[model samples]
Target: MKKITLSLSMLALILSIGMNEASAQKIKINTKGIGAAEKGLKAATFSDADAAKLAGEAVAWMDANNPVAGPNDPYTKRLNKIFGKHKNEGGLALNYKVYKVKDINAFACADGSVRVFSSLMDIMSDEELLGIIGHEIGHVANKDSRDAVRSAYKREALMDAASSQSGVVNTLTESQLGKFANALLDSKYNRKQESEADDYSYTFMKSHNYKVTALASAFQKFADMEKASGDNRTKTEKMMSSHPESAVRAAKILEKAKKDGLAAL
Candidate 1:
């Protein structure tokens, strides 16, 4: 318990170093109707501001509820090392953490919060991890995260935004906050969104002169893990279930790499 508390304190310190008041101002949670969006009633559209607010709330809730790997953890230190080597030029001052969970997953929010599972870091190479992080950043750059949030929240978002316009405060309940976290974490993108993000990742790697095969290799690792788990694959590969099939995505990555001359026959 002491170790966990110490880790959390150190993690908070690192996070505070990476964050600034200006960044926090970008996602002001005090706005009216920002988080009070009701559940269900589809119409996937939301302003950037709305997405930022929800993302901030979702990340905050996730951080509080999850057992995050602290700064002193070997996995967390390694992940920070890998994450720091990248250039996040897609309009977000990204901050990342490794959650101390066995789930193999990583996600990025519109608010530039990226949470990666320690299990994922343990399994992936540094280059492979960068490819995955690039993919997550691609989602943020393409505004897919915002659209997913809006769609999952439905008309409630519009209503709340409207209420916000009228200066009516709309705060979320504890239940609503949990729902938002789940929605953000488990949101599924369509084939198009997934493919587009894949392409963005490819370009991101190529631009950095990183090995393009890292992306394909990462996907192949997931595919192998899936097959190895058999019936228990669902629990092991929870992050891949909502995504494009790993084998298919891997093939696409190879195809793109070859087409760009990053891979040879």
Candidate 2:
């Protein structure tokens, strides 16, 4: 239940999307206070290029550290078959890969690095998987991923870089990159951002002429998982969850689907 914000469900890695319940890795949030340089740097000063560059570095470090599915692996095959042609999805050129992990989650990085976990694939249908991944992509396209990296960049550029004289993100060491990844994943998306990501998932399906209902169904699956997990959060605990309940998100999608004649309510 760390501050990981995911799309369809909480993923342990808490990539751009977090696992609501998946607990493969528990990345402790950096509790260190911002330095004078980080405090002086305005969050608004970060450009889209800075976001992408930082994301690229962090994702590269993660890719090298984690076990990636090979080209001929079933996970990779499935992802490529479904998403290869859409490399330029959402106007961003995306690189897709599958992580051979047990965590049921997927995430889209700011640089359009879309990573899908095999465990998540095992549980979700292709269409449902698409919905979930689309939601993750929504985070990137909507700049949620960018925002997550901005904080990490600010902290790392100030802490690791010899001088923040250029007033932009600077390179980080391997150790600092690990911190950068953790900070990026620990970021939580507010209710509004989550809703927008859901909307983006819906739009992605609609545009692709895929089953838009899968978006709602995907949420329903998460809702069911939460229920089966015996969720008993108090108001304070629920508020600290960092994202809206899956049931509520499912309901919203169903309402929209019903209105659009895409699904029966």
Candidate 3:
């Protein structure tokens, strides 16, 4: 009886230690490198509730400070309608808004918020716009923005900058947030990440029955713009800086479109 009791106590202690170890192990995300993993883990550390709260605050700041104009513009209405059409396709409650900025760029935040720029609309057709929107949506669905925020927090440049003096995790004013946004926009994503987002966008648009060729065409247009406007600062910068070279991006999209049997828009 004494031997049996001792055996049972040992077994219980071992089980307790195993459970504690399991609980203490950090959840690792399947990202590329240590840096990427760190970013992903930081983003994943936020509960769904906390992510939603932060997203809401960020959008509110954008809405109040950078109120998008041309709300009544036909193009604006059309863009909004298209976003509404496929908002729920990814099993997330997605919201869309346009920014009045002239820079030809668009981005999505975590919690399914998409922001499109007005200048991009001036250049892209409706179908092309869909492609851009789809790409931005992919980022949101993939939680790239959250990971990006985490990466920013880890960087000394971002941390020590005046804009980040308040800390990247804290609530920021519109101006402060704008500075952060600009920095992010200027940053180039790794080739692998860009490829993944491209894949996501292609799959998403095809699943939704959109003309995937529009993505290719959109890239072609940007490439042309880059070539034509050599010295013009606004045009060249808009066409060049914020994205990968249009030719490269377009070629990737074309290959995917061929595999997916994408028809022209």
Candidate 4:
């Protein structure tokens, strides 16, 4: 009886140690994952291969589902011109398309795919449009889109109630795709990133000789729209929910412009 009890106690102690070690390992993995993300951001670079793969997947999904119906000929021409100038400038293969959404928004994916909304172009001048495009391009150059993609994937898994599935994940439904698009558009980037993108836009506009003031003007326009649509939950929520306040963004850009000797237009 004594021998049996001693063996049982030894087994129980071993099991407890094993459980503790497993828990610690999990904690270490979590910490390491977070550390890697932070390092990626600090480095401001992404793996070109990873970006291309993600872009291909995202484009395929968008093509099959949310087909954009805008003036592709003119838009593609404009994009080719802009991107052609920047080709070989960055390591990423930056590509763009104009989606037929009426929403005044634009977004870049981790894989160097940029989607601009038609309504966004309707509201802005050519210079203003360039500013917005430059900003999105900055996100790609900085690997912000890749970081956002990773963040979105994690968030979706955490938020989904039916996350217990094995192996492959299915494509999002149309509604889910819309939700994802909106989320990506309205997602709040870290302040550092926002500032960096702003700086990149300034440099891009300055280098290309586009009106840098358009950056601030774009934000002001968004801010005014937000104010005018007060309490109209949909517009207001869309404007303010995911992004930093337009006023704040405008102010920061203006400050940067002044410092960079870029006068208001």
Best by TM-score: 2
State every prediction's TM-score relative to the real structure: 0.74, 0.79, 0.67, 0.64
Residues 89-166 of candidate 2 have per-residue lDDT tens digits of 979989988878655667777888887778778887888888888888888888887887787666654443444554
Candidate 1: what lDDT?
Answer: 0.58
Predicted structure with the largest lDDT when compared to the true one: 2
Q: Which candidate order results from sorting by lDDT in descending order?
A: 2, 1, 3, 4
Model 3 misplaced regions, further than 4 Å:
1-44, 47-52, 156-188, 231-243, 263-265
Off by over 4 Å in 1: 1-45, 155-174, 235-242
lDDT, candidate 3, 103-127, per-residue tens: 4556565566666656667777887
RMSD in Å for all candidates: 9.4, 5.7, 18.8, 18.3
TM-score of 4: 0.64
True lDDT of residue 167, candidate 4: 23
Which residue pairs overlap in candidate 4's backbone?
none
Q: Give lDDT for model 4.
A: 0.49
Error of 3 at 212 (Å): 0.9
TM-score, model 2 to reference: 0.79
lDDT of 2 at 121: 82
The clash count of every prediction, one per candidate, is 0, 9, 0, 0
Which candidate, 1 or 4, would have the higher TM-score against the true structure? Answer: 1
**What's the lDDT for candidate 3?**
0.50
Off by over 4 Å in 4: 1-48, 69-84, 87-89, 154-188, 233-239
Best of the two (1, 3) by TM-score: 1
